[model samples]
Target chain A: MTFLDFAWPSFLAPGRLWLLAVPPLLLAAYIFLARRKSKQGMRYTNTGVLQAVVPPQSQWLRHVTVGLALVSLVALALAWARPFGTDKVPRERATIVIVLDVSYSMEAVDVAPSRLAAAKQAAVDFVNQLPASYNVALVSMSGSSSGRVPPVTDHNIIVRAIEALETQPSTDVGQALEQAMAELDQAPAGEDGDPPPGLVVMLSDAAGTTNPDKSPRQAAKEMGDRGVPIYALVFGTDNGYVDIDDVRYPVPPDFSFFSDLAALTGGQAYAADDASRLADACQKVGSEIGYVEVDKEVTATAAGLGLAFAFVAAVGAVMMGARWR
Target chain B: MAQPAFASPAAAVSSVVTEPSGATIPLSRLAPEAALRRLELTIVRRLEGFLQGDHLGLLPGPGSDSSDARVYNPGQDDVRRMDWAVTARTTIPHVRDTVADRELEVWALLDATPSMNWGTGGVTKRDLGIAAIATVGFLSQQMGDRFGGLIMRPAGLRRLPARSGRTALYGLLRSMLAEPIVPDGTKGPMDLPQGVAQMARSQRRRGLRVVVSDFLTPGDAELDPAHAPAWERSLRRLAVRNQVICVETVDRHEIDFPDVGEILIRDPESDFERYVNTSDEAARLRMNAASAAQRERIRIAIRRSGCGHIQLRTDRDWVQDIARFVLAYRRVAGRLHAPPRGVSR
Candidate 1:
């Protein structure tokens, strides 16, 4: 997401948002009073003497303090409206399938220490952050896809399997999803005979050639139908390249394809062009897939901010009041 | 001439600073009677010799009242003054003579304009002026000398008739202190020059004349030392006949600019107002230069007019300043009060 992007919140008590009108009115009144107090309306025995004596100093600090105070009031008014923002909460139980690309292009050196090694480390970190009760599996994708570790409550086995992965010949992302879906099918049901929620996190360098029988899109759609969402993390810059048969071939991740795949599976897409970004992307994907969305009240935070701003304004006034007089 | 004597510091009491509009302030608050009992204001100009009271005048004269018998000249003396009793006892012609008494009539013209109402140093300029008047009055008033006052406002001038004794002097001071403050922007035909000219035209006989004011003309922005003040000519004319002492009253802040950030400075007697940024050192220097120039111009004008000038500051001790001025004045009074070139003393 770009720096300016924000998730706008919905309010429970929308009618109370009208209280936001108070700050502007107060600002107008302050301006009027400041103008009236500018020495023209006040009486001095001799203005001629004062003209020779007093020089004007910048009152910008005073204005800044007042502005802060006004912002605090706005925050308080927003809290009064009982606004709600989307937040992630830890899931009680879930099954996650990690699909790692072991294609020859994953050996590109654009992401430091090679793309595969960085992706393997990020996947291990991602798995370790999940709840202990969740079942995690690992799948390797190349010319043909196959499961490395079956779905299990203990995530250490999958982390070790990811560390042992090596680059293979061709890349087939559709086959990787099929393999990931087969691993999720093996997840055990709860004592009440209900299957736990399932999520698929895939880290790939690029979208590869697909078979006519199972396209990547068709596989993602089928996974969506089965209540499983795919979170795709792309890890390669456009300048990424690898040498095969003494000839270099560029291997940039197809970000748009992965985004479309994630959309089709009712999930989100993330892109990272470097090792640090790949680590951050892994953490983001882990948090997004491992938690459920819920509404939360943030009134206390707003009120606390309002109180802090008010205290600053009061302290500033006390310190600068002598000069004003 | 004997030097003016000052009372001991222990004998003098501190004066209270009161607002000009405060009518309840006693006369003694400005200048105590005991502090001035020993002090005297020397009158340098030769006054008209007359036996109006027991006080000695600058010049002794012959009077119509009878006195000691003396030998009379045949053509220069009055023949009706022959004393037969003294002639019969000494077998010679004698005449009866009379003693003449000189009474010093002091008229103090107090400027009570709006500018005098300002003071950042506890006492207002108006009250300081009144205090000056009281000091001068107490020093000059004796058994027969009369003390009087003229209050000059923007609209007109009010006069308090000259009267003798200490009680009359107190009454005059009380009247001056009780004068209503002239609100700012009050317009009239009268000003400092006009008021001085009026005092000169009306009080023809003068012994000592004191002009107490801030001497800040409402719209006179001229600061050149060569250019005399608007009232300088009138003061010179008045000095032509009487000894004029110009007591210029000022506040401390008027001369020393304080470093208050930005403030709107305005004139009370005029509509001139401007915003000033005092934080700039250069701006403050410019303002201080202008104020010093203005005060220097006043000093030069007063000197050119040949008047005895003394400046009283609201921040300083007025009594001590007046005392020091009086002591120094004794030496220069003869030179300052010299008659015009065409006239003889």
Candidate 2:
């Protein structure tokens, strides 16, 4: 989901919103009393003589204490509402497997330099953005898919593996998914007898050789059942072309296959033709893989802030030597 | 107990008449008797010699109309007062002198109103009045004069009989110190005018009549043009019979308020309350102007009644103020008593 679409859960104590009216009412009463006090002068033996020596200060400054108190009261009312917000909490551990297409068709220069080069850069950017505690593995898929780097927490090793990739004769999408799942399965189980949350980021043009022994949909179903989501990034535009042996071959990008695979695995699919969209896809994927959402009650924090305001108001009153009416 | 050595009046006066330094010691800090004793010492040590032989005679005495002329001795006779006619006839120097017929009677009309109890300074206006009275009383004693007073208390008028000596004077001071201070908002039976009128009616002696008060009596011409002050007529009466010195006691707070933003002021005697916005510049200015005008009017009233005026403030060193006043009065007296210009006898 987009960042703007993020929503907080409903307040546990919505009825407390009605208490917000107390501060303004108190402020109004204070103002009325202050005005009345200003009108009712102090008792002095000689006002004429006293007026000649003493000058009055600004009226607003005298109300600083009451103003602060009012703010604190408003803060207290907000605290009473028992607000619960959606917080992005870090998972204890996580595993991310980056699958790169090393197929010959990935050499298309529809994007800057070539699609393969752009995909490698996006993979490196994505790994760099992930949390240090996340184990990142790399897989290169062409005629056959292989785990270039076993699942590890060192992002530098994963980045180096992506850079070392070379173009192969054919694409084997089903093999890449199988290799990524194998890398995820190798991660150590947590104390609760469950593996850490896993994510697969596949960067390719979605044009692969068909193999009856391995189906992409079957692989996606297996990963989904195991509670792993695969983020599929389809590179190159629909009008993409590749040059092979001095002859330019039309190899337009196809996203339907990757889109269906991501949908089955409870993940998203993105199509990128340029560096900007590639970076955006990598950033969204990185954030989604690294963090988990949880409901957090902020009542205590709001109460603490309210107390702090109250303390400030009390201190202001004491310092100003303001008398109670 | 060994008796304390008594210094000559002139020597004692010289020692204490120097400009007073520091603040006025509050009565609360000392016992009533001790405070009065300290006041007595201060007054005697500062004013004795300056006022010696300055008492104006009220009756005839041993005369010098050539009737009491005697042969003058060179060392004993006052050379300035040598009788020229007697010297010319007897072929020898002769002098004439006159002795005072009676001791000077000094009376004080003290206003011990509720207003006097208020002071923002080191001491209350009432304390200042007592100090003034002590100063005048001790000075009168040093000059071998009788002292008496009329106190205007919140309860009623208190008449102190004229008596001589330090004991009688201390007794009067002790009584004044013992006088009950009326709290704020208490309605007093008598105002300053009635007190002065009472003094005028009872005390018919020709003496130095001193009136010590804050002089804030309302219904005066200063506050309202149509009405004359209640004390004006009585003060005139006292002024005619006695050498009236209106010692107007003032406090700084009476002239100007401290910068306390808003205050409610209540008149102690009248129980009248007024809320004032001290923060208002215009209001402050107006209050100050009104006070100044009232002071000027009081001065005019004192002048019209043919009485000498001296204002003593609670904030000031009262002894120094009194010394300055006495010195100025002496200068004026010297000027008035000086022989006609170029007419040396």
Candidate 3:
């Protein structure tokens, strides 16, 4: 499998980021359009019987072609804007601890789909895309910093930790980073001379429910001085409002603290208000500070001819399978 | 079909030739003026005979008027081309050249590879190509030549046989009118040196051969002075048998390599393009120098080859240059084999 094409960081301006989800969203919208049209067609009589004989893929093929076209459009758009795999970074390998906020305030609807849900999904996406050799650890950080998964070679455990996360009622942005740094200090000695430089990816809304020692900004700066970068993703805007339990809580989603953290650590700060934007933010973090050489088995065998035979068999099976059905 | 009414058989030689019948008709007897009523009439008239029509390219072209915006000169100019609107607008007198209709047998080695078609100068080199064909046709008609061009059209390389130089021109004109046409089957632009060399080897007689080309092979190490010299040598050798003329066609942007901005220029003939910045004076200078140097060597080669040469620009008055070149060649021709004085001074 030839695994690559044009590569660059795939990012879009916040205003147009919605274009990223245009494909799947449009497909779902088209399905709704079809259902609406079918409903309208049914006013003449019972229409359920007609649906049986009409081939689904024909409709699905139309949908598939539309979806394929839209996907290719996005791929081209991404290609034109430049897209890349995070694993092939220029610098040496580094350690990244994804510190996600799971505090009770994360339950606030200041950000769409709730803050905890966004953070967990974003963190999982980040871990999954990391190269296999990338030393990644997960920290379910809120009232206190607890290393849910320590830096390890395996990726599934970290992804699992991210998926099982729930909203906790407190937060300590400082303690969380400190715990992540401690975990990095203990990673096994590498074959290189210098211990892999450490970095932290802190995804949160930046509202502190607990005043742990050294504010998130202060700790992030101190880490920067130690040659570590903290890329922060602040969830909402300053004018955002949250309604939960029949109480409306206005959020001055203070990302200034997180922005300061990034500036201090010589990293980056991002804003994400939607699921797609969160995915972009995770992608950004991976691109900025991720590089690990995992052994890639690229078998360039002339299987085109062989694959044709298998494809012929598989297609026959499917066709025969359809007859049986 | 009307036949020529001759006072005497000797006077009939001066009669105008008719298309519907190859018969000659006295001028005064023509229906009013010999103007075509409809395109269909002309097409039908042409089909009536052996597709034979009076040669139009033989008529001398109007002198060159290659200007972006031509000014109005009333009695001092061609009053037929007065731009009344411009006169009304600027109050400054201006007159447009009454565009004349003429045809030219245009033979273009249109470079159709991806590069010639891809240019930063809005108009690709290929655009310049067809435009040059049209421009030559437009300009050539000032003298009254019909335009027929040879392009590597959609079908493939179809060489519209060189017939009445004027008839050849009409063929080209028809092709241009068929513009924006995607040639059905085209295995495009040939290699200049190799192609010209082959043509030179096979050509049987002395006739005018005007080559509209940029003469640069794509992706080669910056042009080796030796190659152009060699092409000129072969061309000159060909001149021994034919009246050879090379229209050195080029784009203005190609000449100066103007400091516009950064660009990626792809050579249509060879699918190789490069990111270039014209802002750097040195780079621009080098581009200009290389092009200038190659052309200079070409001039040298052509002069050495014993054939006439002229440069046609997509941006310059190509007709005037062509006219001037033709006039100059006539003068040189008049002098070279001028009957030697008995004293042989």
Candidate 4:
């Protein structure tokens, strides 16, 4: 985000914002009173002679203290409105699931080494980039899907799970996502009644399987209904080839299917020839994934600032020794 | 001839009079009796001892009876008063001297205009003017001479008829002290010269006429010689018949501007206001020069009119200055058989 990008989640009482205009009005009145006071000071009998003896001094400097006090009052008014801004604070009590496809087709050597190897490496890189407070879970899917690592905060366990994945018969993206969600549900609940925000990141070479019982779209619908986003990455090119049982076969990647699945789950879809694009997507997801609007009271802070300004103004007035009638 | 014994025991009093304190006693704030007591203590007692002898003896007199024959000293005795009978008998030059006439009248013309209300010193010019009047009045009372005065205020002229005794002198002094002084409220310029001229016409008696003022008149004798100041002309007319003494009162602020950065000055008599920069050296010098020139003009006018000139300052020991002047006049008078040259009586 740019420097000016910020959010105010909630204002307890936003109606008090109208009071912000009062400082300028009070400043005008203060200026008038100060000028009048200067004019109406002691009346001398021999002003002619007195004028010869003493002249007027600069009055602009005298108003500085009052100006500070007015500004503080404005700040106090803002604090009274109870503003809460969305700050880029550290992510806490969050769970992120990384789903990897270990099907035979993922072994196509189109994206340097093989698609499966590239996915494994991207998964490890994604887990490493996440905030340490986040609990990461690993799930592998082929003919059947299973949770390799339950939701855990240790980076070594998640990395080991990604490295241990082996090639299986076929791809089942829906089962893999369902397994990741099931692991997130089984994980320990946070201090709040509800579980922490959950995210499912699936890395695969979208090769359609003839398994009608488990539909990827239906699975994405379920995750979406649970307010979870499924970020899908297609990791192979159209010119990819795979060898099965000593026979080489051309297995092209279907980017449209994975893109459709990510759209159904309110998430993004990415196509990467190597691990660089996947790594960038992982960093974006880590930064943008989970943020809860928490009410932070700023009344005391603003009032303290206002009081500080008031103290300065008071000290200045005393030092100047102006007649305050 | 033997000099007249004008000495009194009161002459032994210290000539070095202490300067008046800066604290001013506002007469309006005090009761009449209290104010009179303050004036008596502050001004009268200090002057009474030093100036207790005959007031008329300070000036040359025309006596109806001859008193004594004296050897005439050139330039010291008047040629018009040469005694032929004494000269024919003594061979040496002889001049007949006459004792000063009694029943002398002392008239004081006090300028209580709005300008007198201002002073940066301990006392204002008005306060000093009253003190001077008190000194002169008490001295006249001591000499058993009739005392009277004319006060020129911003409102109008006030005249006090000639009267004798201490009570009358105190009453006149109280009136002078009680005159109201308004700040920047005078409607128009005060006609001080006119008032002096009027006073001169009214008090035509051959006596001492003392004029006490700050002398900040608009008329310039050197710049406008054709139309000499009315006061100067009045002084000349008054000097023709009376011993005129001009007690010019001044304040230190009038002589030099203080180093105040800037100021708005308002003329009390004319109600005119002007902004000034006192910190500017050139401006300050210009103001000082103008003040000095104005003072010199007034001095020249008084001197040209052949009157006794005494300057009293608000910041200095005015009583001491007056005493010194009176003593010096007495010493000069004792040395010469006639009044000092150019001095009018």
Candidate 5:
């Protein structure tokens, strides 16, 4: 990326930022001298000859050269402080937990065939796309949440568990998030004895009934505190419904809850009304969680830009100066 | 900063004046007086066929002033001087005796306008012109001969009454040096032409007249040598009854431009201002050519006016230039000043 668009960097030697004051001082001095020179002009006994001889010069060219020189100086001053910018790097160790909603509302056919079928297909695609080295886990949300598969490098086990999830009575998103966090806690540590980076991906149909003591929002907050972010996908449309005992109950998906949960956990939220949209959301989340951000030294890029600007300024100065002889 | 290409040794001496607009130049108190002593000075009025005798008198026989008539001698008295009325009444030739008129008056008109206030040498052009006047005053200071001065500025003309003696000459020089400097863009009815015309009108005498100036008229862009300058008509008129000498003062840098990069060139007497890049060799050459042409035009115009012209550069010693001109003038003074046979005062 170009240095301009690079993240505003952190400085290693911040005290050197004091050098930033030099360019303005230089500009002020230049302006002062230029004004004095214009005011106290060289007097000629006769200007008729000069008028006939000399053509009017492009006065702005000199200012442009000076401006370029000043910009180069500012760049060099910033580079001298030794800056660090955020760089994207692939994580060597990570644990990804997929939570599928298997509530009776997910059995609605608004997402073609059923919401559960679309969720299962998207989850399997997401698991297959992840790096083979990463450990994967699966959890089911029904009357209560439970871990179906523990964190393991074997991706087929998690995919099969996601497909086998059956619809049940209630939607307990809070319980499912708690179970995903538990699975992440049991994950194996790295060679340096630090827990692997973790991400939770949740696919749900509708809002779960309120649990007074611990809501889904509260569980998402706890998951964020444990250094894991949730990427939530809201499946099914507002017209989705389920049938029971000859009574039709409208079970439209609750997008606001998934939006709040994703926001609280520092992750993204997606709403999908069809299987294609669900698959697209799953693909985006897979790519989003694949890398990590770390501060990397970008001093050379800044220095090179400074040198390029300085070189252009010097060339301009020399061209103008040559005629001074 | 790099030194400007046009910077020279002559520019080392700054023109410092006590008056506003850089006027009120001090007298040239340097070594010109000492150096001028060895050179002979003379006004070539006699060669013009008007002053027909030696320095003591002009046409030194019977003067033109009428006196009592007397009987004409047979062979000695000329018929031209005979009183025809008296001769016819008496039927005998009678001649009118006349009183001799003698005394030479010299008037020097110095242009002290704003343009003369500039100099890159030891003295400004105004002060140098004054020095030339002082030199002329010393050269022509005689017992009966009176020396006078006229100072021309943009505002008006100042006259110093003619008087004899070294003290009066010193007084005139002091008044000239005390004249205030005219600020730039000063506008008035008076100009070089008007000033010269006034000198010709007020100072009506048959003697010598000296006009000193840089001869640059403000707002006059005419450069052709064939066309006469605005002041040439007045100068020619002044030269009609009196022998006139024009001392043209100039600065060396006016003709030879130096490489000073970019600079604003301004005219002190006019509102003309321009930025010039002297670094361009081609531009400098063009400027030099134009300036030379300009000076040449001035030289040609003065010559056409039938007056003696001498150029004095601010970069050089004024006294020396005048001395050289005078010495050379002595050799061709008679032949050069001789008017055409049909022309007479």
Candidate 6:
């Protein structure tokens, strides 16, 4: 389901295009007469009485069966159409870092069970779903953020670093992001003189940091300006119930600044509201902007769905027979 | 207290209406004697022009034309009879309108009896009657001949006078339904022949007359030519004059007695009643045979009556059966109406 192979080196299989006709034929049959009563069939006097004695006839169900049959037929046709693709989908040949915010303020149960927990869960999910071809670096932020794993193609290591993150008072998201970018800048570019698209996924509540000189938003904006699209996820309650710093600020800093910073570039910003949405957010960042390769490989050989179509046709015949009986 | 079962409380009081079975059958036209609703009028409209024939009263009376005299067609009848047109259109003999078919005026007849009320099928005998009468009436109207009707019920007959055209057809039909049910059986046994006789005399011209009924009436032993059977002489005499159409209406149970347990039966005639256990297969078979025999009598009566016959049952397809009959009749009439083909010169 990963559309990597088709991105650039898309090989067209002509045979698959021909399979499109079977469904339209079936649709025509569905729309037209199923039975020929006569050239000008006499209109029955009592349609109701005739209906009762006649077998069960479902117009819509037949239409649906015809539709499925056509779909399966097309599938088979495409199979014959000989769909072809590149051997391996192009992968981003570059090192990338993900800085995850794990702070006490992250515990502001604003977004969910707690901002820190949501951030950690998202970072871990993000690491797990990403293509393994790219080297990833992991950095954790608190009152002061630190790099746990430098950018490398070692998914297990990156995953371990993300998992090890825990809530703490150190809330410097800026430091964590800067450290990640520094790690990525040292990596060599691919043969084309262009580094595979570098993606920096930043997970945070954007609710901490006393270092006003370079705020988390400013740090993200600066990093994004230098070619990296900073994918920022802001986890918090818009109602301003989040905790900040060692002292309760009563009002969380409008974390909208971090999202705006990321978006200023052609980057993305996601809101962590649920586990599924958070996972999808990370996956989207990795695929669309990151252009990164995953560890597991996917190869699709479009199988002739003719048999599937035949199965549908059989079901339809059975239904028609039962009604006739 | 239960609205005396027989609508004719007068009859109920007059005689000990020995109900054959305890089942309380309403021995009356159960329909509310209200003004014809706008809907039923439409049912006729839909069925208009189905059956065509000019057999007024549908009985071969003393006045019915039984002569078939026609000239042979020339050049495949394409060039046959041309009187003044022979000298005008072209110097060729072309025959047209030479086929002689005695224009028959079909009188719409309906049987609206209490027994007609029971229906195991989609429609009651009354409903079939409605359709049958409308089919014939519309056909007659379409042919541009005189038409009228007789609507029969257990109560009595309502007579609508013979007239020509669509307005008369509609009026006769509406009036048939409009005739108030005098509730007390005051009008006497549904006069099956009143409408036919009325149309016969009123028109004063011999035409096709269609008599629609279930023919459930018991045969009068004397006048009936056979051992008294169902609808014998009454139908025969009606069919004696004019081109007669015998439309016999029957119901499912009348033909086949389905084992529906002990059903209380009531004879629509005589107000005579008794009990018969339907649970016994033997008894059911016996009753079924008798019904079949009665149907046979009905069939024979219609045949001997010298009339075009059609039978519609409550449990069977009345409309299709009707269409099929009409188509056959039309086929015959079409052959007769076809210009006579020429003999090779």
Ranking by lDDT: 1, 5, 2, 4, 6, 3
lDDT of 6 by residue, A140-182 (tens): 7776677788777878887777767776664666677677777
Weakest 10 consecutive residues of candidate 3 chain A by summed lDDT: A40-49
Better of 3 and 4 by TM-score: 4
Second chain TM-score, each model: 0.82, 0.71, 0.52, 0.68, 0.79, 0.59
After superposition, candidate 5 runs with Cα above 4 Å error = A1-42, A46-88, A100-129, A140-149, A156-171, A203-206, A209-214, A233-255, A270-288, A295-309, B1-276, B280-345
**Each candidate's TM vs. the true structure?**
0.59, 0.42, 0.32, 0.41, 0.55, 0.41
What docking grade applies to model 4? incorrect
Over the stretch B196-309, how does candidate 6's per-residue lDDT look in tens digits?
454455544444667777765532212233664444445454443345667887766556665544333333343322223345666556555556666676676666655567
**Residue clash pairs of candidate 4:** A48-B265, A48-B266, A51-B263, A51-B264, A53-B260, A55-B262, B22-B122
Choose the strongest candidate by TM-score.
Answer: 1
| Most accurate candidate by DockQ | 5
Whichever of 2 and 6 has more DockQ, that candidate is 2
Residue lDDT tens for model 5, B105-178? 88999988777777766567787788789887776655466889999988899889988777788888888878
The weakest ten consecutive residues by lDDT in model 1 chain A span A37-46
Badly placed stretches (over 4 Å) of model 4 are: A1-325, B1-23, B26-100, B188-190, B218-230, B331-345
Looking at model 3, how many pairs of residues clash?
Answer: 44
| Prediction 3 global C-alpha lDDT | 0.52
lDDT winner:
1
Compute fnat per model.
Answer: 0.24, 0.26, 0.00, 0.03, 0.51, 0.00
* Model 4: TM-score for chain B: 0.68
Model 4 chain A lowest lDDT segment of ten: A37-46
True contacts kept of 4: 0.03
Better of 2 and 5 by DockQ: 5
Q: What's the C-alpha lDDT at position B138 in model 2?
A: 64
